[model samples]
Target: MMRKFFLVVTTWLTVSTLFLGSMVMADTYWIDVREADEFATGHHPEAVNIPYESIGERIGEVTGEKHADIRVYCRSGKRSGVAKATLESLGFTQVINEGGVEDVLSKIAAEK
Candidate 1:
């Protein structure tokens, strides 16, 4: 009986956690345009790694709505600049080249 109660509680907690995580992801995300290996080393928790080259093809996977707000960053902002242009070409009306991760994170925190 104790085992069954523990399983039920664990399952409920898992489901609730997943639901809340999905809710946060669905609302907003900032893209990290660094390569996969580079991104693996370090990145912001909420940042999604989508290399600038692949962004044109893969951005739709993140958001199909062309007008959705999009923020992008990389090591020195160069890659994110390309990403910004690519997103704009793809009809994403609100693309922000947020530069480095630290800079962007601070800006996001400030905004919050």
Candidate 2:
């Protein structure tokens, strides 16, 4: 009986650890809240362009879940700030404003 209980506990712990690790490694989306022209000029390799003006309308199309971590940037801080606000209002809990294109690029480079 004791051996069986120990085996169950060990299995539970291993499964729990794997589940938590996967959650911690969830994808973080990089979004560029710039217009098509600006985005076409240049954007982060991992970023998806969702123009600031259309953020509210395309929220579902851009993000997978409300609680997903999202990093946003634009031509200037202004648009990203707007996008961040819109996302929060729409129930997104982890929207981060990464400022302009250059700023985000530097940040991504630093992370690497």
Candidate 3:
């Protein structure tokens, strides 16, 4: 009986660790780096608006750590590129420039 209990507990811990590890690896953040008016027209369901100019001041709303996986987009690629550079300069490790809003929309659709 003691041997069986220890075996079950070990198995449970292994399974639980695998499940929780996947959850952490799956975390991602989407941001829109356009003006308020432009973002009001359309944006990704998972995206949060924080215009390019304010990224330095408001990026904490997305994440405080420098190792977060963040995806940023805008009306055009220009602003998003600026945001990516700004984030990288701030010590971010994984800031992806997701191009324009339309580009990101098309990319998501293609993935589906």
Candidate 4:
């Protein structure tokens, strides 16, 4: 009985470790273009807040290595679209316009 219990516990631990490792490796990043106040109200998880107007100045800071798949968001699609264009021009290869902050936030929450 003791040997069987030890084997079962070891098997459970190995499977749980694999699942936790996969989850930690699959995180994604998005950019929230809402003003500071709006961002404070609610925003995507760990999203970088760089308002549209100041995006150009903050490009390097946001896209340090230029290798991230960045999704941009704002109050509405208009600002995020513009931000997407600017990001593309700055050589960010993967910029997704998330339309509106509320919409994007809802989608992400539902996915989880």
Worst 10 residues of 1 by lDDT: 21-30
- What are the lDDT figures for the candidates, one per model? 0.85, 0.89, 0.91, 0.83
lDDT of 4 by residue, 75-97 (tens): 88899999989888887777889
TM-score of 4: 0.69
Error of 2 at 68 (Å): 0.4
Cα-based lDDT at residue 95, candidate 1: 84
Q: Can you give the TM-score per candidate against the true fold?
A: 0.68, 0.80, 0.78, 0.69
Model 3 stretches astray by more than 4 angstroms: 1-22
Q: Clashes per prediction?
A: 0, 0, 0, 0
- Model 2 over residues 78-102: C-alpha lDDT tens digits? 9999999998998899999989999
Model 1 misplacement above 4 A: 1-26, 108-112
Q: Number of the top candidate by TM-score?
A: 2
Backbone clashes in candidate 4 total 0
Candidate 1 on 1-112: residue-level lDDT in tens?
9999999999999999999976755565579999999888777778888999999999977887766678899988999999999989878887888898778768767988
- Per-residue alpha-carbon lDDT of model 3 for 1-112, expressed as tens digits? 9999999999999999999977875778999999999989989889999999999899999788787789999988999999999999999989999889999888889999
Candidate that would win on lDDT: 3
- CA RMSD for every model? 9.4, 2.8, 3.0, 7.1
